[model samples]
Target chain A: MAQQHLEPTDPTAGAPPKLSTAVEQGGPPTGDALAGYLRAQATEFLRALRLHRETGTASSVEESVDAARALRRSARRISGSLHTFRPLLDADWSEEMRPELAWLSGTLGLEHACEARLDRLLLALHRLSGSTPFPAQSLTSDSAGSGPPAPVTPERGNLTVGAAKAGALLERQLTLARTRAHSTALQALGSSRFHAVADKVAVLASEVPLTPAAPTTDLRALAAAAEDRLLAAAAALPLVTAGHPYNAEALVHGLSPDPAPHPQDGPWHQVRLLLRLHRYAREVLYGGGAPVDVRLLAAGQALNRHRDASEAAAAAASAARTPRIAPATAYALGVLHADQRHEVEAARFAFQQAWQKQTVGTP
Target chain B: MAQQHLEPTDPTAGAPPKLSTAVEQGGPPTGDALAGYLRAQATEFLRALRLHRETGTASSVEESVDAARALRRSARRISGSLHTFRPLLDADWSEEMRPELAWLSGTLGLEHACEARLDRLLLALHRLSGSTPFPAQSLTSDSAGSGPPAPVTPERGNLTVGAAKAGALLERQLTLARTRAHSTALQALGSSRFHAVADKVAVLASEVPLTPAAPTTDLRALAAAAEDRLLAAAAALPLVTAGHPYNAEALVHGLSPDPAPHPQDGPWHQVRLLLRLHRYAREVLYGGGAPVDVRLLAAGQALNRHRDASEAAAAAASAARTPRIAPATAYALGVLHADQRHEVEAARFAFQQAWQKQTVGTP
Candidate 1:
């Protein structure tokens, strides 16, 4: 029922003569629909790519952030669509394009990630430094209405010199690092690998690689297969236990010696990706005509969160290792490290719980 | 230089000699030393367990948190030591016990994560609900000292009815979930699974199953080998890229064709664990006489952060999926999810940067 509710519903069902309605309703995906979808995504990708090239070098950070975000989204849409509809397209061509698309996305994501970290760390440090230990007013207030106010707990100068120094170190290093990454991304974009991919995609709008007179294919099977693969992968993963979930040896010990080998944590992350594609496929094909699976959407969304948290914690650890810095700075870094690590743990626990619920009773 | 600095340094080089120092100066691991280390960890593990049993059921949440923290730490130490010193024990027995420990840790971690999420979500909502759109003072007043003050940006009421309902739903569900998990953990601690583990560990402290006349082995070599395995595994992992890093197919494509294959994300995490064990081994064998690999420590520490972030993001996502709730609450949940996801991205970027630096010129 949850899955059905989440499926795309055709709000315009049985509407009088609309071009979009004819292709989307009560039928498998035809070559025309696949081609149309690919073209739209390709066009959007190029548009974003061009905008990025134009504004990526701008002095304004916000501009670059916006450009990068747009580029990533469009690129993702193009890539996802290509994979989902590949059965109807030239397999070799689709395969060739996937890697290039991936490289572009990775390059952009790297810079954006750095910029985001810098902003987060800086904001946190600023708040920490700005906070004062005690209020200016005396503890013994003579206000009639307010009963002897609870003892104003003094803010014990929480921001140590080490903390401030650590904050400064983070700012300096993260800023430099982000700038470097951004430039690297820009360079990559300008490289032949990127240009070749871009040029290919630019031409794809007018000429999609659909097979000649391809029959309509039921996308539901593809989507189900994707889901099944993800489920199987998850089942094989060493289930999270009470001890250190990150401990590899313990996980290795738990691995089933079945022919279908259980993958490591990395592949599990891949499962998250497949889950997303499956959800997107459902959305694109069903397009409000069919009910979506909420559980799948939820699972995909949760996996995204898991991946994000895992990466962030790694970044924070890097930040913590600012090196040869003052004791104050080191202390601050430690605090940051601890905070980030806690967040990582929280995310893992949440995923396990969510995944367990999602998989229950689904043979 | 930071890595070098983090390496272990001998503290008592010129100090008076102790009986323990005789066996630790550059030789293979002796059975007695292995026995001693295992015993110490077992003692710590049991002590923590008793404390947990005593305090876990307390009315005060803080007490339970503290006890759980202690139990987790001791359990981790025991588990780590076992993995590092497995050769000194019966292989089958060590393998059998590892899973039970993992189960215990995972259970406790679940409760802790839920509690943390509930606290975080509630605090965020409080802050959001507390903020007003505008200042109370007259905007027309032109104070001489203040002089052309920058206009204050209005805080648009971002909290919709859907957001509030979502927050409440999260609070209620997360709170209930945490309580249920806490009780479950407590129950588990008293369960047969737990008792069996405890009884096994108790027997382990007194009698270690070391190989007959096992020659003293160079622990450094063992540690290095461990690190190498981790690195190899990391190398095999399809490097997390921008495009479809979440996609399972892309990741699988990156898998090596060799029989002794390395995993991607999973191996990187394993590297963190091996690094920790190596550091601990150094601490135990050298007794502050040998310096630690600062780079290794830093790398491990960063990995820990990565793991934490990954887990936390998953938790935040679970929180966001407060189903069948108010639309306003749903909106709030969405906002929370986005913010947390951004944090996750930031962390991943940081880790990549750190890892690149940490692994320069080393295959």
Candidate 2:
């Protein structure tokens, strides 16, 4: 029952194994095994996170980003393990994953890139012009130096920077191609894929593994089960909405819907169900949580970490001569200042609003 | 012998007239059934000559352009049918194959863009360079005409020209991906997929108007037979390549191996033995002839077509003044001219020399 309420796998429990896992596994193992393992895990991580996003249960960008970061961290750990695996292989394995993953990740990276660049561009353009606002100053001085475009820049970059504003149409062509391809692929994976994979994992967990197993089932079985659940979940997702499809190459397993309900009952019902199913099966086999959440509760602690981050940022800002930053940060700092001596007690309504609008939406 | 050759329910026979077949038949289609119907056939029109190439099988720049033309034709057919599917869907009837075919055709289009761009880039760049044979006077004048560093003839416009070069990369990527994903998926729906599907189709076809009657059989028995064949074929593939150890997705459906072979081999054989078994199966599938040789013959035809294309270009070049073209095209034209043709008269001698070299290990 304790397992029934939580994420089964407790993904946070993995924690990239803290670099120590690599140190501990500590082997100049054969190249074949290492490379294969690394490739498999990294690919799996991307697939899993892509699935998470497609579920669309998260209400905010922060939650989405948190999920992405968790997946990325797992992938990195998997990649780190590859360091050991690479030396074992007869041929370079990096190129193999790069081309394949790039086909998918390159597109996701493009979105990230656009977000980063747009943010930077906004930052550059938005700084106070000796003291005036945008468009008033966005126009070039047409002479020696152009004053800052806007008196007070917006906290983030504007989406209005079309190809003309960026540069010649020619310059933007390749970037557009690269970005569109990535964005399309990423969006597809996220919108419906999460449900698909969850569905798939659930199926495999319910079924008995074919191979002779010492630990009940092997890594292959685990992966196959996960893939099964994910694909099934993706398949069940309503296409009229968003997310990955039932038949994309990455999650190629046949989708079969779960006969049971998901655990947690979060935004993603399919994911909840499949995860629950897998957890149950895994527990039956290995005595772990039924429908394991895999360390997701660790993420619940992120709110605490965010508090620390806020304090650190406030201290740094207080020390700086230019205490004023963007309005967003200013607002954030204001909240931090009010937190002193529990001085923010009167803001219960505000806290509720923030939790509903921001925290729930984010991590 | 006929039973061995003919899939009991001939897919090409069209939907049977009335609901008789489905009432007699029962259940959904299997993977085996789906594959049996989709295998491409060779007819006398296509079989007149099966020319094969010795090396890489990728389509060239020109051939890819032609494929675009066919794709456009197919695209038109699909879009025209969309109205047919859309209206039917509104009527609560699923127009399954048409939509899927449409998507397949649409993805084929992305390949065309790559081809056209490659061709255009090559064309434009050639035009930028004067007519192929140089007028020595203009060459000198052009070299001396760099009056200003930035304008008139700057290479800025040419930077994006690399887009043409990237076209091949795009095409190659598409071919590799789509081929691995859909082609394999389609082919994987073999006797097992099809037999499963055949039951469904038999029912559906019987319900749908204007189709032939499905042959009678117990679906379970047929499905079991299909599974036997499916496993047999899937077993022939190397499920765990040294690098890709756990992906059963491709093998599970019998997509990895040549379909012409005895695709009934299950997952029991060692990868090496399975490969040999597939070859033997193919020979059995096609009386005494190897698919390897058939593919080779087809390639030779493509190469001959290319050779013919080059010959045509050379003849045109000989008849006309040097063309204004990209230096690349001029280079390509030169290459076309240099195509070493193996004439019928000396081919005998060349073969003897090659045979001798192989036997004696000559340089």
Best by DockQ: 1
Model 1 residue B258 distance off true place after TM-score fit, in angstroms: 55
lDDT per residue, candidate 1, B186-206, as tens digits? 789879988999898788667
For every model shown, what is its TM-score relative to the native structure?
0.41, 0.21
Q: Over 4 Å off in model 2, which ranges?
A: A1-19, A25-51, A68-87, A90-96, A135-182, A187-363, B1-150, B153-363
**Against the true two-chain complex, what DockQ does each candidate achieve?**
0.01, 0.00
Fnat score for model 1: 0.00
- Candidate number with greatest TM-score: 1
lDDT digits (tens) for residues A166-217 of candidate 2: 2111123334644685558556565555435334323322331222222221
lDDT for model 2, please. Answer: 0.28
